[model samples]
Target: MTSGIHHFTGITADVQANVDFYAGFLGFRLVKQTGGYADAEQLHLIYGDGLGSPGSLLTFLVWEAAGRGRTGIGQVSELGLAVAPGSMGDWLTRALTVGIPHEGPSREFGEPVLRLKDPDGLIVKLVGAEMATPAPLNGAPTRLRGVTLLTDRASETAGFVSRFGYTNSGNTGMTQRMISDTDILDIREVSGFVPSVAGAGVPDHVAFRARDVDAVRSMRLSLEGHGPTEVHDRKYFLSLYVRDPVGILMEYATDGPGMTVDEAPGELGRTLFLPPHEADRAEDLRAMLPQFALPGEERFPVRELPFVHRFNRPKEPDGTTLVLLHGTGGNEADLMPIARRIAPRSSLLGVRGRATEEGTNRWFCRLDATTFDRADIRSEAEAFAAFVEGAVTGYGLSADRLVFLGYSNGANFLAAFIQLHPGLVRRATLLRGMQALENPPAADLSDTDVLVISGRNDPYARDGTELADALRARGARVDFRALLTGHELTGTDVTEASEWITRTLSLN
Candidate 1:
């Protein structure tokens, strides 16, 4: 049986900030970026030493927009990483240089420790001691040293961990120190403490290393009736999960076919890897995942603009830029997958709606179920126009090569923008959209090409046709197509939009 910790899994609400701190600031090499085991929508990031050894891994599940979690009983309250002995001062200096607030070179467990919190507020203790793993890269911490598990039943938890070769080494106050070959287990007894909440920044589970598949199975058999044990094939490793007596989640994972199983060591974290089951929805998954830039990389900086947006530069550019607008309750990243499918080589710009209704996002305020607030529409349109102008200037994009794609509420806003500010957008695609303006001014759009795709059974189909009519009256060449669907988009939408974009680009 393999001893010591395999890895610790935690939660992070902001993927970009988390990556910046762990991979950029802390200098931990990002070994893998993949979807979470339970849910493919949330990202799972693995950071470790160069080779991504079993005992050196720290993983996080990206839970965007989740609230902060409470750290108390039945939770891993702190993560400890090992640095070379006598390196506490240098680590503290680095933290200060990076503008990260940290506390103390205080002595803990007879070792110097510098304490800090991750972006999501997870406590991290950088201990002064060399770990039994690979050498540190970029002066990053060597490896995982220990984890502090707060629980009311510390003795029971200690007994449980002892099954996996953790022997009680010593104690300090209310904490019992258990030692395995490569990791330490600090079980701190918090009597009558509240159990931890499941949210961002809280440790989800702690995994122990298993020698192989047979070892994992043997461990599962040893704990045949312990709470619940379910084995899962995690592609890189076979694992079994169970709950300890104190309700803390625990796992035994195989260490072979490790982090480099799918990706080369040099290209480990550059690409996002999905499970075999989700291979079919690869493009959609890639688009849905949050876009982030590595630190020191020349990328679009998130600025304080009129509209919140995300930009994705393709690995290979075709000199075309597509600006995307999402529907009601949708965000900037919502339409990225569709945009990528339509124009794979084009740069994608996804802009979020500014207005909100009952907590959900909208391009403009609606007066009622079927009526929109015209004043709000006009104000937002002007702001959106300003954003487009600024984005073109800031991103150094060619105005004539910008193609607009909008859906539903976003499409309605785009329709208003075209009418109110003609000659700005050269090409546009409206998906399940309608006219937002009750009475529109006449403007010449002779230089424009538009595609209006509405669902045949959509409630807004009649209004969408009127929008197409409005565009055509303005002298804009329009390709109107109705698909057999409802309000939601379909694969046929991608097909029609792609074909229309190709035709327009050819003409350009």
Candidate 2:
């Protein structure tokens, strides 16, 4: 069940036009054409390379005139295509040359991508998937990897992906990873559409790759679980559908090798690699096929970090940033999931704590493991504060409009850091706060959206009147809430926090 996305299907406006764009313009193929399998209410069209293997495959519902849907903070924003490595630069140039305006050549989740707007204004991305291999999963050498998009309801979408045999890799992004051979999928969470975008573009709808009926049933089994597997027999292929937490539609595609399996791996994009079952219509498809752009140069660049921070560039005109810090034992990867929470425009940069406590990320000394060492805390607080100042200034991220979020030890450090140096965080959320550092770190918290979320009864980062008074007195606009749980963050915890941040970030 830990397989990457077999495929995800979506409803679209134009059937032939959709096929033209994804196939002719983007170099995918029509793997299938038929009545909707799970829902006879519509038609389904499949496209991708090499039978839409692992990182390929896209399907649409051909809902040509469906009114625009509202995509919000917890919505799936875009779907990414893994293009030739080191080809973004070339593709950007080519796209511009061909009048296909592109926005990136920037880094996202530590990789390169070219962000563009499709005919429908849906966000489309072409990424330089630089990994050598994908994670293990149950499948046929993986025809589809994972569906990529943004979701306000992360766990919801994750649950949906789980149905298609996708397992979490613990890495997140606006476009995150599920597993197969290498990263099979890339899903992102887009807060909203880009300004001036005209139509529904990239993720007209997500589609997964599948092996055949057995694979389809396997995926259905994964999705249905203890109950009966949801199955539908369409004219073209058997399928199943479901709505994940965030409300995005997902589909389990079938085998028959589709278009990708039609041609040799090296010839996937050279010609129309249709499924063998459709050989009789090859000439007809070719005549109707649109010309396509070959894989191009990689435009984005990724550099290693010498210090504690990681910089993941966004593939958009507007910019948003997530300054990540790890708790004990949590390094750069700790706050990566949090970074994924900031979709569409935001990028992630993670910072590791300076000192180690019991081999964990500790900013200062510990007082018998649960208390604080006042002086050590103060020194570490100042140290992190200075780091933030330098980072904001040095990294061109001036404290304005910036979000600083942390957890456990990392949360303690961030709380201390912000208090000591007000204005470093425009809006901040502390997963589990610490009250031991009652020093009132700074005196300039005006203009900051202070969030202190806690488990109902947690010891560390425990909330009491002291925390509320301290943050409020420091001029922080605080939303301190204690949830039903203790110390640990449930998906519910993250869900609430995401909700709060969404509201806080949208204030006039």
Candidate 3:
């Protein structure tokens, strides 16, 4: 009911590392370290400018356990921050001066926001706002103005947000309204809900505006991140956010002189935020964060998983249940970005391989090229079957509603699964993974809709065109494409796959 960006959350294995990553590298100030509402031994970390504005705060649950919590169905998608609109190009120049991997200074639906994922996969959005109030807290040069959450029940969340005077805006029935005395809070609820598995990308919490330390403390009385809340004086703005009902982390932010006090607005994101404690040694902090801007936006919004943010989260959308598997060394969290982008209309259940390959994630055992032990395949296939059966039964989906999406090593096992269980998957999306299975599976893909995307320059493909021809000869209703890419995935490449998937179904 209160205004501001607050109540953002997520789970993590290491709290300090997470904190360092945010406060130090990302330029967020450490405003508080509170007791965990769900777990006491577990700590809650709040990082943001001290202004105490909505969307300026962020909350976290640093679990004592080694296992990571899955970001899925019952979670917020991302924390959208309103930044200098049209200044995305300007932000890009500054973000590059510092070292950060940016995905876009691009558009989401329509809003121009920068998209960056935190160390643990939580998305943080930064967009341009027309009427940002003068910040109150002064901890970081930058401050929080507002926050947006992508949810399965946008209407329900908006119902809660509207309690504070927010209204619905956007062409897609999104909720928008002026939250503060003037700041606008935009919330959109669409059919864009994608169900993710335990390890998939998802939001755990979010925080809102914390006008002052007392208000932050008052908020701490009712919020989890406030238990051991730390007070900061960043000489810019002070802020914080704690955990919420759904466990997604949040933050409270504020803005007065803003990040531009030192540099111009054109240079806002070009530099990093240094906390008061680290301010004297700001140069040292600046040297620590990654030095490459991975080519996208300048100051953008932090989205949940791209898939969760881009597509609708559905228990069952269009009667199909899309199962996604990740590659080795990576968990289920990594692939959902591509999964959500490639198929915004399908319901997704992205999976992480059960077996850990020493340090990396893999579908099955692989000693080297062309060498896979049957023991690994058999066990993984069995696990795959069990996983498939459980998902289908749990979600009440039939074979016709089941789809397969696997990357490199993921496809290795999936191809094996298709060989082992002939009619399980109704459609298959195999990207950069078809090679490991040189020969066709024993089963026929006639009834199944298959989209095999290969990169022309990939060494793994041997020859991409030949691979496409081979699949067509196998009697599969296949739509094969060879893009001018390597094994690496790109947004342009993803768009091609998305178009193919749409056409695949439309033809049917």
**What TM-score fits each model?**
0.86, 0.41, 0.43
Give the top-scoring candidate (TM-score).
1
lDDT of 3 by residue, 1-508 (tens): 3465444556665444465556655556555453433332334555555433334555566542245445454455555655556666765665576655577877654658777666666666666655443453322224444455544565556555453345654444454433555444555443455543333234554445445566655655654532344444434445554433332334454443344465553333344344444445443223222121212323222222212111124324575556777777765445654666566556656666766556776777776766776667776777677667665665566565567777767766775676566666667777776544445455665666667777778776545445445445555667767778888877866786677666665655
- Candidate 2, after superposition: displacement of residue 76 in Å? 46
TM-score of 1: 0.86
Candidate 3 versus the native: TM-score?
0.43
Question: Can you write out model 2's per-residue Cα lDDT over 217-272, one digit (the tens) per residue?
Answer: 66666655433435655434455655465555555556443443344544443443
Instruction: By lDDT, rank the candidates, best first.
Output: 1, 2, 3
The local distance difference test score of each candidate is 0.87, 0.57, 0.54
Give the Å shift of residue 248 in candidate 1: 3.1
Model 1 lDDT tens row, 173-196? 999999998779999999988889
Off by over 4 Å in 2: 1-306, 313-318, 342-345
The number of clashing residue pairs in each candidate reads 0, 66, 113
